[model samples]
Target: MAEDLHEIVARALMLDRSAITDDLKYNSIPEWDSVAHMALIAELEAAYDVMLDTDDIVAMSSVGTIREILKKYDVEA
Candidate 1:
């Protein structure tokens, strides 16, 4: 799951894999705006095979926050 998350962040946010960090935040940079956020969510749902609830979607503020959300679904990434 972490691998998938990494790829999603890299691709959707246009960040290199080496640039990925736990602090990756939506709109924190130009690449993380609404379009990228949508792309990231789509990528994540496809990879994790679970739909995100509204609250989870709202709470997905950063990579660190994403980890916490995924944990609720029993996904360690």
Candidate 2:
């Protein structure tokens, strides 16, 4: 699940795989803005085949938050 999260993070941000992490925050860098946030959510839902609740979406303000939210969905990370 961590690997899956990393994959989603890296692909959504268009970063190198080595650059992906749950600590990578939203808007902490220019590449991770609101648009990227929504896109990332879409990518995660697609990759995991699970729809996120609106609360989950709103809570995903950072990568850490994202990981926590995914865990609530039983993503195992």
Name the runs in model 1 displaced over 4 angstroms.
1-4
Worst 10 residues of 1 by lDDT: 1-10
Relative to the unseen true structure, what is the C-alpha lDDT of residue 18 in candidate 2, on a scale of 0 to 100?
91
Candidate 2 TM-score, true structure as reference: 0.84
Error of 1 at 60 (Å): 0.5
For residue 43, model 2's alpha carbon misses the true position, in angstroms, by: 0.6
1-77 per-residue lDDT for model 2 (tens digits): 34567777888989888986767877888878989888888998887778998877877887778877887777864
Quantify all predictions' global Cα lDDT against the true fold.
0.83, 0.81
lDDT: which candidate is best?
1
The Cα error of candidate 2 at residue 56, in Å, is 1.2
